[model samples]
Target chain A: MIDHFALSQAFGLLFASFEPWLWVVPGLLIGLIFGSIPGLQISMAMAVFLPVTFGMDFLQAMLFLTSIFTGGAYGGGVTAILMNIPGSSSSIATAFDGYPMARQGKHNEALGLGLAASVVGAFVGYVLLLLLINPLAALVLKVGPMEMVVVVLWGLTLIATLNDSSLSKGLLAGFFGLMLSQIGMSTTGVMRTSVGNPHLLDGISVVPAMIGIFAASELLRLRGSAYLVQDEAQRDIAFSRILRGVGETFRYPGVLVRGSLIGAVIGAIPGVGSSVANLVSYGEARRTSRTPEIFGKGAPEGVIAAESANSSSEGGSMTALLALGIPGGAATAVLLAAFSFHNIVGGPSFIRNQTEVVYSIILGNLGQVLLLAVIGLLMLRVLGMVVRVPLAYLVPSVLAMCAWGGYGITGTVAGPLTVAAFAALGWLMRRNDYPVAATVIGLLLGRMMEGELVRTLQISNGQPFNYLFERPMALALFVFMLMVLVGAPLLKALRRRKLQQAGR
Target chain B: MTTRFPATHAALLGVVLAISGFILWSAVSASTSLNNLVVVAPVAAVLGVLLPVILASALRKPAREDVGSGAWGDLLLLAGFSAFCLALTHVGFDVATFVFVWAGVVMSGGRGLWQPPLYAAVFTVVLVKGFGSLFPYPMLTLVF
Candidate 1:
């Protein structure tokens, strides 16, 4: 599995010129800034800056783009902790506990935990990429729409874990989000709930809606609070606490490693990216935790699980891009575009002839992870200042930024309109004890599930029952989902009944 | 044993079911083909069945009290957001952003007369100019 000669050549290529190293820090900084913003995505950041790489060589461009990928992965978690808003869908789970930590005046520690987990996760992902790049590429080729549907179903199980209050409310919120996702034209050329509007044909834009639901809704609730932290004294950003938080991850080495592995594997899958990986990792961490009850209630393990998985997904996603010429998501798609810009194609052939180049890219990313730890610490200090802004000023200003960002996304008023509408929905859902995160996740997965289900049906000639039997991977995943959905709860009830009988 | 009817929870449930119902109706009415209702219809049906259970569960438990300041305050903030969204196209993102910030600060209990406007102006300029340069499209602005 090890390529010593190529590895040595890779090192030579990287250090041969200081040109690539020069772009790494700047790329990471750009990614962090873009990913931290409410409406901006890491993909968008890369896309906007893709033109900048035109002047540079392929190695410089890859290093720069990958640096952004590394930085944005962690940067997305920053806002998720500082504010309730996740910088991107990938960081959604990070907000599960990170925001609660912020409210309890543990923002510095939460940021630290997230930063550390991200750094470690990315490092692990790259290491795994070095070992399993060939096998991962082969696995991606065998995955069909049936498997994609099952992957989405696995993600949907997260709604079950997300709801702390009413399970029914969580299910309702998630289904509602899925239904809302079907507003546009379907994969099969059928319109569901567009109401004859031309704009709705494209479906609700996820980012703006996400910003509305998470950021705007939380701000509405926070209208009463003077500041983000309830305690005034704890609001200060302490580097020591941040350092302590970093140290805390070593205590839960299991969660860190598990999250990293999950992220790498899931990230390698085409179409299913870090967004789903983080949720699945969070659910797994919650399920296996001794203190499962405190998951969404400011558990540091939750932060580690989420941040680790999301950051590591970058390496996993790179596997698909490098080995199969397939872009796992928008970010990788931009990377692929960058590849073509240099007249280099990504596939088995590219991996075969250019093993050293591949090693160089992976090695460059490993170095980027170290820089992220240092740069990210300073970033956390700067972004932790969001806690100091008064809610009165922060609310409308952020809301306006959401609106502007919404427009920046769709280049139309519909973006802001969706944000407004979803903000109202999110506020009502939150008020009624429903999980807005469930809805958000549902919205993210709904399109993928529907589109893939249709494809599965088409592939099976409208009879998926027989096709299900043929696809063992999909069948296995389905069984696992059932175990998670039914068996876990049934076992829990059995345990409860036995305890009651013993007490009697 | 007496159980209180959770009016608010029930109302929220009703809203959710109504939306689900609309979606279901649209999907079925538009095309009953298996492709269209493949995902949408099943989810809607599940939500329908789940609503009564949710209602029963809500009746069994005490409703969560609204922790927000008041209904009116939340509504006003939401209304302010809506107006800001609309004014972005009509007035300009800059002017709308300024008004929204000023109005939001005031609505959220900021009592200063000059401070809100000054803060709003500075924020709007910085936000508009900053994002305008960043974004590829031209932002509609009455005053730059």
Candidate 2:
């Protein structure tokens, strides 16, 4: 399982470079800036600076891109922790608890907890990537589309529990979202619901729609309140609150470890990267916690779980890129382009020939963990002031960002128009007591689910027994999901009853 | 207190069902030539289940609850942003953003009108000059 010779070669590559180290901080900063913003992404940052790396050596370019990766992974959590907005799809779950915590006037605490968990996640992922890069990539290869369906179903399961109000309303919201997700042309080349527009041919743009549903939509709801933190007591906040939040992460060692491990493993899988990892990690944390009820209502453990998983997934995603010559997600796809720019082809043979280069990237990312802590702490203080902003100012400014961000995406008025349309729709849904999160999640995963279901059906030749029973891993996961669906609430109820009896 | 009007609930559910039926029809028309009825069947099944539930909830008597914070302000805020989006198509992002955000501040029932527009001006400039110049994405620049 361990390659001593390759390990030494990896260390030698790290020691062989002092100049490449200079690019790490800059790359991390670019990534942090891009990822913290609503519309910008790590891929966008990498693509912009990719030309700058054309003149550099392979090791230098690798360090620079990896720093950006590490920084962006953590940076995505910032907005999620501070506001109800996720900077990207990956941090959507971070907003579930992180935003709630911020709403309690614990914005500094949530940011600190997110930063701490991110560092730990990245560190754990790097160590695991070093130890299990080969096996982990191979393990991900075994997870076929049926397994993906199970994974998506795991997320879908949360839709019912996500809203404690009414299961029927939540289901309706989720189903409606699912219907909307199919508005564009699908992988099999059939347009489901384009609604007579050429732009709709590509379907409702997810980023813009997401911006409207979460940020802009949420602003309308909070408009009645003066500040994000409605309580006057929570107004007098300070930077020291952040340090306390960071310290609190260590209090739940189990949550940290479990989240990191889930993140690394999920991150290693192709196509399904941090986006799914964070949601899955959050679900898992809530599933096993003693206080499962406190999860969406501002649980610190939820923040740690989501942040840690998303951060570790970066290291996990790199495993596929380095070991299998496959891009795990969009960010890794950009990194793959950078590899080609430096005349480096990544594969099993590439790893055999240039193992040291691989190690250098890992070592570089580990150092980024240290740099992130310092830079992140400073950045959090500035971002923490968002709690002070009145809802009146916050709503419009955030709306402008969303509109432009949507414009940045569609490159047209359609972007902002889409946000406006969804804002109205989302507002109505929320007012009707529906779970907007369920709707958002449904939109996020609906297309992928449909595509996978089609592929699975084709592979099995319409034979349910063949496709459903053929894959052991898929079956195991399906069974496990069923157990969770049945067992979790039952166990919680049983425990509650026992506690009630003991009191009597 | 919580209240539910059976008539209102039924009316809303009827509208939802009608819209859903239209989408389901669209979906049926869009299915591939092959055996991929995956989307259509599940959606139909869900709608089938939901039809009865919506009806049942609607036919029931009115229930009571506390009044929510639904005000005209939400509508105003949404309309303001939507208007901004519409303006961006004609006047470009820079101008539309300035007008929309400024209008948003004024309409949000905030006390000071001047400061919001000033802030909106700065935000619009940064979004245009800073983010627009760097990325390869072209911003709508038709100045009206």
Chain A TM-scores, candidates in order: 0.96, 0.95
lDDT of 2 by residue, A147-180 (tens): 8888887877767767746677778777777777
TM-score of chain A of 1: 0.96
Candidate closest to the true structure, highest lDDT: 1
**Which TM-score does chain B of candidate 2 obtain?**
0.72
lDDT of 1 by residue, A52-94 (tens): 9999999999999999988888888998998888888899999
Q: lDDT per model, in order?
A: 0.88, 0.80
Pairs of colliding residues, candidate 2: B1-B65, B1-B66, B2-B64, B2-B65, B2-B66, B3-B63, B3-B64, B3-B65, B4-B63
Point out where model 1 deviates above 4 Å: A482-504, B1-11, B59-69
Model 1 quality (TM-score): 0.96
How far is A288's C-alpha from truth in model 2 (Å)?
1.5
Every model's TM-score on chain B: 0.85, 0.72
Best by TM-score: 1
